[model samples]
Target: MANASSMKIRVEELESGMITAENVIEPGTERILLLRDTILDSVMIFNLKERYNVDEVYIRKNFSAATVADEMRAEIDIHQSLSTLKEVFGSDEDKPLTEFSKEATKQISNVTNELITSLYADDNILLKMHQLQSYDDYTYKHCLRVAMMSVTIGKSLDLPRNKMRDLCEAALLHDIGKRTIDVDIIRKPGRLTDEEFEAIKKHPQNGYLLLRKNGSYSEEILNGVLMHHEKYDGTGYPLKLRGEQITYLARIITVADVYDALTSNRPYRQPWSVAEAEEFMMGGANTHFDYDIIMAFLAAFAPYPVGDRVLLSDGNKAEVISNNTNVLRPVIKILTGENADEVIDLYNDFKYLTLSIKCLDKDGSTGE
Candidate 1:
């Protein structure tokens, strides 16, 4: 059944370019089959009915007037909600179990709901969200970022609606166990002792126990929270599960979680540059991460985001105006030198093979 603001129709009746209003769910589960705002074509419609056995889909009441602002609002709402949750949780250090459980469920639900609503609305929304971030609260912002990225990867893989929701919830709450750890250890400004590092590794189990004690979340969700830290190379924490032993949802969250952690600023180290983070993930492929999921993560990000000033191999400076189908290459609009104002399509031009991005143009300097 569709929500009151949306409508439902059989997959057979879906037309090309009609936007899905809600995530297409697998029957009787939280897995997401297709994401909302997915513009359906004939093949997709066929696949929905045949390949995945999706019967009907929910669609927004109107798409004619949809704008990027709607997606922006959803992003803002998530940040605001997370901020509120932080305040509520911090108000009383000795708050009851019911209080922690209640607020945790409410905030997870709120954040994931916003993620579901705005995920497929526009490809640019996540990039825009990144630009709007403030580094005040690492846990709240980091969890939300991981949730969005995990959902993006899930949608790319065509995960069922129910599984997608589960993935989102799992990723969003994966760090909830940090609440139980000593604040001094969790927020330490310096590198930790070996004992403290061991304490840090206990978060996954602590989170799993907390959620299980809450008595509301599913076993799958608990497993996801418990195992997201397990490595593909058989070297992670707690039980040290490896390869296929880890849950698939945890596998997806692992990639997103590590990527955000590497790229985000922490007290002990400066944030890795985006290029550095991407390279690090690729290098760890098949070792720290599932290879296929890493490829999907690669596809989800633009190394040089749109609007960045870049120096080209051909002695020209340009702005990344838009992306092409390739994540590494983009359509650049030249800003200086012989090709000023020229729109260069790196994926198409024959000479593009000989050229590459030299560096990002920073204030009066070029940055790698």
Candidate 2:
């Protein structure tokens, strides 16, 4: 057995390679179907239920209950941060900042600090704490996600503490200029005219000017906001800065920005699945995004988030239970087909069956 910290699950739900947390006994016969600490496989699963008539088994918990507790706390912290951001930028449309003394600005920094602290507190709790948001208040929601993602990339890069803080702050406010844009265009349900698209492109410059006028932020922060739209190949708007000319902070945020934008639901389109988004980003390497930052992002966030339902190449649908080092191939709890509720690691089972994520279930989990 894997100690007392195990969770009991049904026999049908047992995943191959999971060490038994407790002994399995046959129903009404008192016969031991399986011994403690046995590694479960498909063969054992069939024999235990069909031959020995066992209905349940136990497996070690992949994560601790404390992770759930930490997630709850993180949600509260994120809520507080969003509230502060809303107060600062919600109604400030067309009213450019002339001074930097507002309490709201300081509160935004404080909120970022708390978020950075919480993320560093536990690596496992990083993506586990993310909460899905409604389509309403899209600006605040998007900015928050970008901030967290940028911070996550910074952590993966093992950046200095001060650099991480600055990166997160810049990420959180990178889209502040969008607040001043006309809502009709921002949320247009159809393709924009050339003029409308041009208007949208002005947001980065608008955001930079607004922050620079406030006179409170460092040049790095201001540049990050200004140049985030700048692409590596010099095709980006406003500045068209290429390669090293683009600020490092801006380059990092750009990867996070494009990722959040693509994976999120907009008025014009549904959100892409996690797999699709990652594939898109990977395709953009060196052309639309910096290759190094893109690689850092891949290391930071897994391609498939836990609990996402995915259709497999073999025509089975499964819920992701745990991630392996290989992001594309995770351990899944099969939810349907002949192997209902059984778990398997796609990476390890390559010889038996070819596996690939067909598509994510749209209703069950957030693709981000």
Query: All candidates: CA RMSD in angstroms?
Result: 15.5, 12.6
lDDT (0 to 1) per candidate: 0.73, 0.73
lDDT by residue for model 2 over 47-143, one digit each (tens)? 8778876766666566445644554455556768787877777653435443344575687789788778877876433442234233456778778
Per-residue error for 351 in candidate 1, Å, reads 6.7
Q: What value does the lDDT take at residue 100 in candidate 1?
A: 46
Name the runs in model 1 displaced over 4 angstroms. Answer: 1-72, 87-103, 267-269, 306-308, 313-326, 330-355, 363-368
On the 0 to 100 scale, the lDDT of residue 307 in model 2 is: 61
- Scored against the true structure, residue 125 in model 2 reaches a CA lDDT of 31
**Cα TM-score per model:** 0.69, 0.69
CA displacement after TM-score superposition, residue 177 of candidate 2 (Å): 2.0
